[model samples]
Target: MTHPFDLSVVDRWSDERTFDVTPDAVHAYADAVGGPSPVFAVVPAMDLVFAVAETAAPADLRTRVVHGQQDLVLHKPLPVGEKVTVRAAVVGLHGKRSGTTATILVRTRDAVGDPLNEQYVTEFYRGVPTDLSVGVAAPRLPSEPPAGPPSAEAAHHLQHDLPSRYADASGDHNPIHLDDEVARAAGLPGVIVHGLASLAIAARTVLAAAGAEEARLARLSCRFTRPIAPGDTLTTRVWADGAGYRFDGLDGSGATVLGAGVAELRA
Candidate 1:
């Protein structure tokens, strides 16, 4: 029997999607991720990634997919009210021990073709088997905290209602995030927060610590080390690393939940 996910879709670019960035949308995204500074005139960077992925996902494998990982590189801050074009393509596909992984590349450019940002998103489909041979690589991180004391640290209390609010704002109504029964069926303790939501909070902390304009963020990358339950307190610690920073996020129990985090700020 053929797999539900069509692995043959790999390496094909989807049709281009045009988006008009609006102030209201930006504000709503900021509110969903806990507010960012008013100085940011662009939409939250991750919003673009999600928007493109919405159009890029394969129709055949929509329901049982989960976001596995993400890496974002921003060329510049996307200005509100500007028209941008997004294109997505499948860049990599691998068969892992647990499931199949599909890596999608989304690139956004200005109306005039100036590059704005690029994102690589990995999605996992549980129980879907693939014959495609590919290797799995683990994310690299420092075994211990950097030599010096952390440059910055902040604690964020993830409210119980955050998942619902994020789901509404992000258009990701995955039952695993909203329905307790659905989560338990999937072997989770209960409704867990979205990994992107946690990344947003971590990004906010990095932006604040660098004291650089939010628009100047050039790159953000992290590995989701653990699932975050609603109402958990997240503590982010950052250390200076050249023109950027290396960071890690810990849950209330001091377990590192987001690791191998790196953020680059434009000079």
Candidate 2:
């Protein structure tokens, strides 16, 4: 069933949550996705990811859910010392294989109600589904022309906490990415990187793409597409476009891990 929604009501929510921004927090997020370290991005990302899940709608989720895809777009990089409110609405839903798989559309705006970002999140939660035991992506979509070679250097490669250091970085006590026993219970191979952690890397990539010099950079946004495992190597890519630039987060294998990454330039 298509979830018909009033774009207006969703925008003007009866309930709203306020987040006081800290430049440190925003930068930390960006740093995670920027250069790799012990794995800081996962920690910060977990905080936002689950919170966003709740904010989107409690009634729409289930205990068996998994994050299939997530993305963040930005009119501006979330600056420090700004209090922003994320107004999220379920804009669309569709069933491809009779509820075996689907997409959840959500858009979050800044405190003043300006469009901060749009997310095209797809969740696959159903049975009799196609086999994906290998965690390899299934093929779909028409082929597009190859992208031009990236003009910018990789600039940064970051590694957040391995399974060991995640706790100290982001306060996410999620056992799936840290504790081996807990990961077993969750049926995970081992510790996985936090989704937000990966997003943080992407954010930093955007900033770099805008310009390595802090003075020349503008705003940034990202959309999280897939999860980054703890041992994975994160590669940042940027292209020098017109006013700003385009940036993205990629795993070591040269895969497009996140889709719809954006960044703007300063005057």
Q: Residue by residue across 139-192, what tens digits does model 1's lDDT show?
A: 334556556888999999999988998887666677889999988877678998
- Identify the leading candidate in terms of TM-score: 1
Compute the lDDT of residue 228 as modeled in candidate 1.
86
Q: Which candidate achieves the best lDDT against the true structure? A: 1
Give the clashing residue pairs of candidate 1, or none. none
Off by over 4 Å in 2: 1-14, 23-64, 77-79, 98-122, 126-146, 155-175, 181-187, 212-226, 240-249, 253-256, 259-267
Q: What is the C-alpha lDDT profile of model 2 across 133-249, one tens digit per residue?
A: 221122232133226976564533435464344344465656666776766565556566765566555555555445454434444444455556666777767776677666666
> What TM-score quantifies how close candidate 2 is to the native fold?
0.59
Stretches of model 1 off by over 4 angstroms after superposition:
1-5, 37-64, 126-131, 134-149
**What are the lDDT scores of the predictions, listed in order?**
0.72, 0.48
TM-score of each: 0.83, 0.59
